[model samples]
Target: MALRKIVVLIYPGMHPFEFGVTCEAFGMDRSDDGLPVYDFVVASETEQPVPTLNGFTITTGHRFDEALDADLVIVSAGARGGTPAAVPATLAAAHANGAAVMGLCSGAFPLGEAGLLDGRRCTTHWRDAAALAARFPAAEVDPNALYVLDGRVYTSAGTAAGLDLCLHIMRAEHGAEAANVVARRMVMPAHRAGGQAQYIEAPLPPAGSDGLSELMDELLAELPAGHTVNSMAARVNMSPRTFARRFAEATGTTPHAWLLRQRVLLARRQLEAGHEPIELIARRSGFGTAALLRHHFQRHTGVAPTAYRRSFSAAGPPV
Candidate 1:
């Protein structure tokens, strides 16, 4: 579906930064890129100024009525210990009317209250996932995912994951080209796969563990070379089994997964730099073949290499 209208529901104590992610994703003027501009409006329970989670206040100048015909209705970040009395019905109606309904962070509570999350795979910020599940016994809550889309209902982890969800929506509604334009304008990765576990900052290893850190630095520096779990374990002078356990504890991901992510990052940088052939770029990024590069690249970025190059290569001066 082409999303032309969006209505964001706001409340007292809502986080402004989270609200801004939707604004940044849909409200921006990107006509020069030949992208569709949405009729984005912010709505509230009342027209009165609503105080934010921070000290300041904001005025939406819109009412719940604005959501009736919206293509998308988003519930922004807010305290979700309880659902706002009037919101659940409005959100339920929007979803039933074929509008895509989304919840950012704790906002999932309202969607849950609306009975929209029932039997659907959904998520909230990891911190609130348990509460959401407990409150709505039938909902399938995925605590580890960065975002979950079940039918037209979407939910995401805290703050930045809202942007990831929005980009995903854009890609689904428009195409890779439009989403890439907005991502480039925002200076963010057009897509991020895996899950939110990678974003949660784990406690650091002991101070004496600097050797592992140094080894990781070297691995990143030499990402163009093929890396295997066995080779990496040898580099750290440890048995493969021990290395795998330690790697998981430290990075929240396995060695192969991390290597693929790094290679994709390198490939993206190369694609943005100039009009290099996909085969050469693939080999330089350590994928060794254009087909392998295409598989992983599209898996992560949602666009094929040549299409990504065409979308970005001539858009600006060489980096």
Candidate 2:
């Protein structure tokens, strides 16, 4: 179905950045860029003014009634430290009607209140993941994911991850070409998978780990070529078994996993920059064949290679 109506539910103590993510994705007029225009509205329980987390106030003229028939209903973060304030029942009804429901950051709390998250895989900010799960035992909360989607309900981690989920929805609904236009206008990455880790904070390695860093850099630079644990260990002048253990300690991920991610990242960069044949990109990105590239690319990004390129390429839309 064509998505045309979007309603963002706002509450007291709403964070401006969280609210703006929805507005930037759907409220802006992008018809000039050949994108679809949505009937976007910021909704509240009452039409009264709502205080923001930024020490300011915002007023929306719409109420819960306005969201009853919306194609998508988005819950914005509330004030009380990721614990939502009173949520309207209309949100539950909208979900029952099969409208796409999304929760941005702490917004997932309201969905839980509405009982929309029961038996669903959802996620919130890392800090609140445990709380959300504790509050709603039926919900499966994944703290590491950037976002989560079970059926039509969507939830994201803190802050900018909301933008990622929004763009993914746009891409899925409107196709890659249309989503790419909006992403380009906003100057954001066109796609980020829901399965990606929420936070990748690794402090500087200890003094002796410098060698591993240099070795990893070399491996990254030589991604288009064949690599194995033994080969990498030989390059680093260490036993393969010892290299594997040290590599995991330094990178916090296995070598093959790291290589796969790097290759996919490189392939996506090339895909987004220009019109390149998928096979050529596959070869350059070290996937060896278009089929292999497609397998890993889809596993990582939740979209096929050609579709991904079509979503972000500067040339005309994907065929």
- Model 1 — which ten-residue stretch has the worst lDDT? 194-203
Residue 145, candidate 2: Cα error in Å is: 7.6
The alpha-carbon deviation from the true structure for residue 96 of candidate 2, after best TM-score superposition, in angstroms, is 7.5
Local distance difference test, each candidate: 0.83, 0.83
lDDT of 1 by residue, 1-319 (tens): 6588999988888888888998899888899899987899989888789888897988878998888899899988788765567788899998888899999988889899999999999888888988889999999998878888898899898887889889989898889988888988988778754243323433333344525777777877898897888998998899989988888777788878878877887888898788788899989999999999999988766668776666556445445
Which TM-score value belongs to model 2?
Answer: 0.69
- Model 1 misses residue 302 by how many Å? 15
Error (Å) of candidate 2 at residue 293 is 1.5
The deviation in Å at residue 243 for candidate 1 is: 18
Candidate 1 pairs with clashing backbones: none
Alpha-carbon RMSD, candidate 1: 5.7
What digit string (tens of lDDT, one per residue) describes model 2 on residues 211-304?
A: 8878866777898999998898898889988888988888787778888988888898889887778899999999999999999987776678
Q: Give the worst 10-residue stretch by lDDT in candidate 2.
A: 198-207
